[model samples]
Target: MHAVLPVAKPIRELHDLRPSDLGPGILASTEPVVLRGLVAAWPMVAAACASADAADAYLRRFYRDATVNAMLGPPEIDGRFFYNENLDGFNFAPVRVRLDKVLDELGRYRGVEHQPAIYVGSTTIDTCLPGFHDENRIDLGGRDALGSIWIGNRTRIAAHYDLPDNLACVVAGRRRFTLFPPQQVSNLYIGPLDLTPAGQAISLVDFLQPDLERFPRFALAMEHALAVDLAPGDALFIPSMWWHHIQALEDFNVLVNYWWRQSPDYMDTPMNALMHALMSVRDLPPEQRKAWQALFRHYVFEADEDTFAHIPPAARRALAPMDGDSVRSIRAQLLKRMNR
Candidate 1:
C-alpha cells in the first residue's frame, strides 16, 4: 500500500527521511536519492487508492477555484511535450484555466479510448489552488519556499534542469523520472534557452525513440542515466541543475514538489552569469580562452578561503567581508558597468 509492488534499481534508497536530513549540507551527495514511502502516511495518498473520483474530491477540498496557467497538447504529439521538429517552436500551447475546471475535465475522460494531454505544470499552491499547502507539504527548512503542483494525464515533460533543489512527492498515480547527472550537461543536446517550453532548456533528442544518427552523443548520456518509478506516496529528491525527464504514467496523475535553495540570499542566480559568459567568452580563440579559464578558476571556481589574506581588513572595503549591504553595493556597481 505504501508504494507500487516493486520497481527497477540503480537508484540509491533512503528510508524514514526527516526534514533535518535535508537541511544544511544536503547537496554534498551529487546523486539522486529516493526517500522510500516518505509520504505514504499522508491522507491524500489514501484517497488516491480508493478511486479516481475520490482522489479528485480530496484535492478539490483545498482548492479556492482560482484560474491557473495550464498546458494543452493534441494527442497527435503522442504525449511527448516538447519543441517542434524544426526546433523553431514548441509543440504544445499554454492556456489559463480554473483548477476546478481541470478536475472536471479529468472526470470527463475517465474511460475514453484516447484523451488529450492536459497539464497544469508548476502552479504555485498559494496563488492558484489556495490553502492546499496547509495539509500537504514537506518539512524542509523552506518556510518561504513555494509548493508547486503538477497535474496531467499520461503526459511527458521533456528533459530539463531546474535551478533549485527539488523534493517531489507523488500524490496520485505513477511517475517515472529518468535523471542525468549535472556533469552530463554537454551530452544532453540542449535546445535554445529563449524558446523553452517552461523557461527551462530541454533536450532535443527523443529518449523513447532516439535518433542516434543525429544525436550521437546522447548514447553516452544514457549510459549515466538513473531511472526510478514512483507510486502513490513515494518521493524523490532532485538536486539543483540535475537534468531529469519526467513521465506521468497513468491516465490521471498528480504531484506536489518543493523547490528551495541552500545558498545565501545575497548570492545571485548563476543563470545570469551563464548568459553573460556566453556573450563575453564562449567563442574566443583557443589561447585567450585558456587564459580566461585561469581567471575564472581564481575568482569563480576556487573556494573563498583566505582570498584576501595578504591584506588588512581595514584596507579592504568591498573585498574584506560581505554582508547584505555590501552585496547590494556590488550589484549596483555591476549594473552601472552593464549600462555603460
Candidate 2:
C-alpha cells in the first residue's frame, strides 16, 4: 500500500532527546519531528523488543480486569476500519471487553495471515493500567497532558486532524505515519463532520488504494505528504491541526500518546464555531455572508491589538483576552441566545 504512492520526504529526526528536552520550543514547532529512541530505555519497550508475548505479559501485570471499548472487524475489512457501502454505518462493530481478553485475542491471532481486526484506542493510561506510568512516563514539563494507549494489529487509520498537539510513543511493534500540513485539509477530501468512525472527522480518500479519478485533489495532498516509520521506543511529535494517517505495520502494535493543547482549557473547541457558522452564516445572502466574513477576519482570524484598540478596556468585555470567568459568561450568553 505504501509503495503505490510517490516517495514522500522523511520527517526530520532528532536522537538521544530526554523527556526534559521536550520544552516549549519543541512543542511550539509546526512541523512533525521524529525522536528516535526517546523511550528506548522504557521497560515496556524492552519487553516489546524481546517479542510480542513478552510485551503482552508486561502489560498484563497492570490489567485489573477492566473492560475497554474496542473496535472489531472481520478479516475481509483488511484491517481498515471504515464506513459501510451506504456510508450510513460503520464496517466495524464497537464492543466492550476486558483488557486481558483483548490481549488474549491478539495472542490467538498473532501470526495468522488473515485475522479479525481488534483495536483498543484512546483508553486512559491511569484508568486501565493504574501503575503503568510509575514505571514508564514522560515529563511534559508541567503541562497536564492526557495519556492514552492504542493497541491494535495490522490496522490502518484514515487521515484525521487533532485539536491538541500530540506526542505519540511507539512502545511495541512497528508503525508508520503519513502526515500533511493543516493547509492540505481541502485536498484530503474530508468526510462528514457530524458522523465519524472516531470523534473527529477523517479523510474519505483511502491511502491504501486512493482512487485518483474519484478524488483528483488528493494528488495535490500527496505532493505535500511527509512519511516516517517508527520502531519500538521511537516517538513522533505531531503539531495540532496536522492531518495524519497511521498504519500499525507490525502484526501486534501498542502506542502510548500524550495529548495537550497550548490554549486555555476554558476556551471552547473551534469545531463548535464552525458548526454554528454553517447554520447561522453559510446560507446568508452572498453580500451578507461576505460582510460576516470580513467581521470574522477582523475579530477572529486576523485579530490583534489594533482590532480592539478603539474600545476602552472596561467596555471590551468579549474583546478582552479570554479567562475562565469571561468564557463562562460568554458561554452563558450564547446559551441564552441559542435557547431563545
Candidate 3:
C-alpha cells in the first residue's frame, strides 16, 4: 500500500561534494542536488557520529545565553508547523528563551510518551551560537552571504519557497526534505502571502495527512516532487523559488544554512515586481492583461542574448543592461511614478 502512494522521483546525488563544486555560479544554478557526505567531517556531525548524547554535549558548548526566538505547538498537531484553521495566524505560539534552556528541555523529553512540538527556526548563528561560523564558514569569494540555524525536536516546516539560493547542512540527528519545482507553485495550494504563519507563504496541504478531499490538486504537485532523507553531515543545495518541506525525524535536530542572492546585491527581489503586478495588473481586462503578459515576456522573462541585439545602443537607454547607478536611477523614477 505504501509503495502505491505518489512520491517524487529520486533526486540525483553526488559523492565527495566539495566547496569547489559549490562555486557561486554552480550554487546559483536552478538545478538542485543532494551532496552526500558533504559535511561528514564537520565537528557537530562528528560528535553525533559518536553518539546523540555526545552531539548534545558538543552543541551545549556553543549555546550563547542570548534569548532566542522559538515556537511551541500542541502535540496533537504532530510536529507539523503551520497556520491555524482560519488561516489568520499560526497555530504555534512564539517564545524567547536561552538557547541552553531549550537544549536542556529537549534532554528532559528523552523518554516522554508525548511532548509538545517546539522549534527554534531561522535564528542567526552569530546571535544563537556566537563562534559557530569560525569553523563552518564557506568561502564564497568574499560575497556577503547570511547564515541561520534551526534547532528543534521533531518538527516540520510546511512547504515554502525562499527568495534566494540556499545550502543547508544537517549538523545533528536526521532530516528529510521534500522539494517541488517552482512551476508547481499553483498546484501546491499555497496559503495567503500577506498573511503568512512564518515570513514566507506555506502550502496548505499537510504532507503527513494530506486532506485529499479538499486539496485534490496537491496530488498533481506530489507527482513532480522529490524527497530525500539526510543524515548528519549531509547537505542539500536548494535553488531559489524551489518549494521545500522539511521534517526532523529525530527527537532533537539541528540544521544550518547559508542564503545568498545569485544576482548582485544592488538589485531588489523580483517579488516586489510580483506584488506590484498583483495590485496593478492582475485585475485588468482580458485583452489588456494579455498585452501586459507579452510585454513582460519580451522585456523581463526572455533571455538577454538577442532581445536587444537589433536596437542601437544609444537609442536603447532603458532597454540596455544596467549597472548599480543605472538601477538606482530607474528605481527613483519608478518611485516618482508610483507617487503620482
- Model 1 misplaced stretches (Cα beyond 4 Å): 1-9, 16-29, 141-143, 317-321
Q: How would you encode candidate 1's per-residue C-alpha lDDT over 13-114 as one tens digit per residue?
A: 777765344654443346688877878777788899787789899888888758988888887887888887788877888898888998888778766768
Tell me the whole-model lDDT of each prediction, alpha carbons only: 0.81, 0.92, 0.84
Candidate 3 residue-wise lDDT, 1-340, digit = tens: 1223487787778788655456655576687888888888777788888887798898777776778898989888888888887887888898988888888888888557677898998898887778877766565566567899888888999999998888888988899999999999989998887887678989998788788778878888989999899998888989999999999998889898988886887888887888999999999999999999999999989848598889888777778887898789899999999999
TM-score on alpha carbons, each prediction:
0.91, 0.98, 0.92
lDDT of 2 by residue, 239-309 (tens): 99999999998889999999999999998999999999999999999999999999999999999999889
lDDT of 1 at 224: 85
Pairs of colliding residues, candidate 2: none
> Judged by lDDT against the true structure, how good is candidate 1?
0.81
Ranked by lDDT, top first: 2, 3, 1
**Best candidate, lDDT:** 2
Task: Kindly provide the TM-score of model 1 when superposed on the true structure, using C-alpha atoms.
Answer: 0.91
Which residue pairs show backbone clashes in model 1?
none
Give the Cα error of residue 237 in candidate 1, in Å: 0.6
